[model samples]
Target: MNYGMVFLSIISNRFFDLLDVLNKLNELKLFTLFINIKEILLDLRIPKSKQMRTLEQWFEEYAVSHQNPKNKAIHYVCVPAIFFSIVGLLMSIPSGFIANTLKLNAPIIENWAVVVLLFVLVFYIRLSVAMAIKIAIFSAICLVANYYIGQVFPLWIFSIGVFVIAWIGQFYGHNIEGKKPSFLKDLQFLMIGPAWVVENLFSKK
Candidate 1:
């Protein structure tokens, strides 16, 4: 006679029916399909905070080692320079093999740097979409600059020169800060450094 009992019975029946369907899927050698669906449901049940670190959290940790004004100022300059140089170095690598292997015809997306940056963008996206977009814009600019520089000079040599000098400056700044670079603790902070720099440049806060 209870309405609540009727509702519970209906829900239980539907739940069991769904489980039976899932079991059939597994028996049919579609175990992967069942596992993927299970994983998706589990992922949805997990809270966002438990899934990944937020952009603010990454920046907060990065800021710990970059506290001193000298360190902060140096980072403002050196981070972008280091990022640019790495991109230039990547672009200098021949992409003919990658292009041939992938059967790609697009000139714009054929460079090694572009291929690498796509993965980098994925990392940024996992932290924050806004961060991803910002890094993408900066990466495009680096690509353009490297393109022009490669036309007139050896990009690999230029990148190596800038990379060495920038690291020297970075170490000096960290010495002034009296803290080690954040990447020493975890290599992921290497990617975080550029995001932190971009946030500082664009964010009013």
Candidate 2:
């Protein structure tokens, strides 16, 4: 009898036996369940890559109702419209008193819109840095547009009119989608809506 070959055969048999038991457990669908239970009972740490990926997935999932082609197209136009209208409306408001008090009188681009955009960017930055930067650039364009809109027309009146019309388009889009807006469930989705729109310009990878 060759002792080394005998020991190797014994080890191979034990390995095959373990694999057989695992295969049987897998057929019963208990292998994963048992491991999960074991982890829970033992308070073991499970890796979190799946959850990390799902966090990004929430943006697309939350925007599911807007997936309809017409609805999405409408959002592409209306979300920015509603956003810039609000910014214009706010910029039209006289923050001159606050500016005077704080001595922040830069005369252009330092107004209620700038103040509000600062706070809004905080919310976006917490979600994604790239998104926050995109929003800032968008806000800058809106500021310039606000100046132009104010130059050509009554800023508040024009902004309010656009705001109302843009929102009407939004509800109409949702009507086409056969679902309510996600912001109705949680207002954070209001911010996520813009992020979803901006992120579409980039690839999934």
Candidate 3:
């Protein structure tokens, strides 16, 4: 894939993964709820029929190949969740710090900008209405988190440091897997990462 596509995949994968972890932590008992939320997301995106069937078959095979339902589910959820959480946490630190240092008089406006950017990103990925709504909810949560974190930290230092650290963690995860990352093949795979995890979770039921 092109460099821009790769970059988008990387960022999108990381973002959705972060949302997965945050959602999990916030509502462990409501895992199925998240699955329903994901279904809504899928509805909005309108994935290709052939690709959808292929993905479903691939996931079923993947689940069986692992031989442990729990492990499979954990793999689906934890890998992306941890990878993306680090990314989000890293990026947010710097963003938060920068806004603080600049004395951005209108934090709300900045947060709205971030939300709008997220919507654009999701749109670019061609997410469905349901998926868009889920992402909007996550973006809203991230904004609140960003505002609070910005109030507490210095932006430039936080941004650079977080980027470095999170990237290292990401590479480490890939190293263990010993495979070129999925986004390298298809940029849309980035959006699929979160839905894939949610699919695995629901597949168990």
Candidate 4:
């Protein structure tokens, strides 16, 4: 008898719940961090290209060269290791010039790895907001781990070792798959590789 009123009440409650979440993000000063490329495109009045692809499209293309079970298993380990090693190498670079030029002094923000991660985050944000958030969390962990590991060993040397070893593992995996790595065809696939791994891992759960 009062179906219309019940529907309105449910909608009202959901609207307020969303507002509460937004407020929490604001309180944490992370509201801006969650922005995506669609918002940026809209702000600049730019239209998406007809040829532009979605995240899943990139994943599909990447999967074409990674079909073997052995290759997939190797990627499960090496892709992340390569990413972490790259970040570690960047972290090892001196950031005094960058910090001085920007007049910024915070240890975290002054890091070369942290600076590069911002651009990396933007790349993921263009693909998907959820993916970007996942990557951002993982990037933070890499920074923390590199900081501690550096105190015990030379960061650049350690990063170089990991990088070389991980690539060796990757080449071995591709030999099993009998196909060239996708990144050889398109350099952007290097970025797609990590996102593809993260997307598959999360989808399994």
Candidate 5:
């Protein structure tokens, strides 16, 4: 007769024990979730400050000396004009074999600018993919502009004049800056200059 009461008591005790275990498990799960979230936030905060800066950093570094208002003003025109002139100079080379191979109706389509600028684009891409894309687009426009300019006048002669004059202006700006141009030390600065200009312009706005 007493067996039934004892059996009920045993069942009640086991139920309470199970409830206690479940509560502890729930508390443990909440604590673990909190720890994971805290760790994730810490990871996000830490790596960014420690990681190396991107190509943009290099641009800003080069820009230090160029901060002189006179120098900054000169670069706004000279950098792009120099780039365009280089494209024009390359285009001035006689089409030769390239003219016949593609047989495109537009002479400019298969001209030296496209061939030469491809390598330049790869150079830019190696530095920074996003900047490279922007430069590639701008270079394509310059090539098309060169094609038209070539139609009206002596292209190579004009480009050389532009290149020399622009460079003179650049050096004059640097003199005012009282710091040497970055390109003076490393030729890579030549490629980086245009991107630096583009990034600076956007950052200014």
Candidate 6:
């Protein structure tokens, strides 16, 4: 597999797990759901197009082909629902820790920083709903995992360990496909890794 596939697989696994959790929480209020969807979608880094209508039309077509007719809207809504829930839970942990350590009035304010960052990402990029959902899920898992890993191992050591493991999986996937890894040509392929898996899942459906 190539590095891209490896990165994508890890992200896919985490997102699938999160989807399981979101399925159980599908009863949230409409306004809350809309806000969460907006917040989570805001984290995509897609480049803008001069004609957004064309892009929207393309996405609509893609959605119809990839998503079940009965569940198309649900998929978009649920994907982000799962993503933001995981992020909210994971970020709260460190935010509480930081608040206690620094004696802050509102430790939860740290989450606002994350919110601001997501706003910047969405404003700059134009990712599909599925892509945004997958990225959000995987990014949250990586952040939480990295935090705990850093406590056990030095940051550099932990990073190197993850890099080695990730690369090995990636090369294995590439060996099966017999194609050059996407990352070798464009760094943005790094972001596409997770989205690719999500697309595959949708295609299967």
Model 2, 1-205: lDDT tens per residue?
9999999999999999999998998899997888889879766443354234342775766767778999998988888888989999889988877688678556457688888999999877766787899899989999998888798899999999999999999999999999999888756577777777777755375
Instruction: Please give the distance, in angstroms, between residue 52's alpha carbon in candidate 3 and its true position after superposition.
Output: 9.4
lDDT of 4 by residue, 153-185 (tens): 999999999999999999999999999999898
Question: Each prediction's Cα RMSD?
Answer: 10.5, 16.0, 23.1, 16.5, 15.8, 26.5
Clashes of each: 0, 0, 13, 0, 0, 10
Candidate 5, poorest ten consecutive residues by summed lDDT: 44-53
What's the CA error at residue 141 for candidate 1, in Å?
0.4
Deviation in Å, model 6, residue 22 alpha carbon: 65
For model 6, the stretches where C-alpha displacement exceeds 4 angstroms are: 1-125, 201-204
Provide TM-scores for the models. Answer: 0.72, 0.69, 0.44, 0.72, 0.70, 0.39
Worst 10 residues of 1 by lDDT: 43-52
* Candidate 2 error regions (>4 Å): 1-55, 102-105, 202-205
Go through the candidates in order and give each one's C-alpha lDDT: 0.88, 0.82, 0.54, 0.88, 0.85, 0.51
List ranges where model 4 is wrong by over 4 Å. Answer: 1-51, 101-106
Alpha-carbon shift of residue 61 in model 2 (angstroms): 2.7
TM-score of 3: 0.44
Tens-place lDDT digits, model 6, residues 77-186: 43333333344444434455556666657433444335543763463257565556555565656456645554666644545544555555555545554555555754
Candidate 2: residue 119 Cα off by (Å): 0.6
- Error (Å) of candidate 6 at residue 81 is 22
Q: Can you tell me which runs of candidate 1 are displaced by over 4 Å?
A: 1-51, 101-108
Error of model 4, residue 201, in angstroms: 1.4
CA lDDT, candidate 2, residue 194: 72
Question: Model 5, 1-205: lDDT tens per residue?
Answer: 7999999999999999999998997877976888899999887672553234468676777887788998998998999999999999989888878978887767776788889889888877766888888898899889889989999999999999999999999999999999999978656678778988888776556
Ten residues in a row with the worst lDDT in model 3? Answer: 61-70
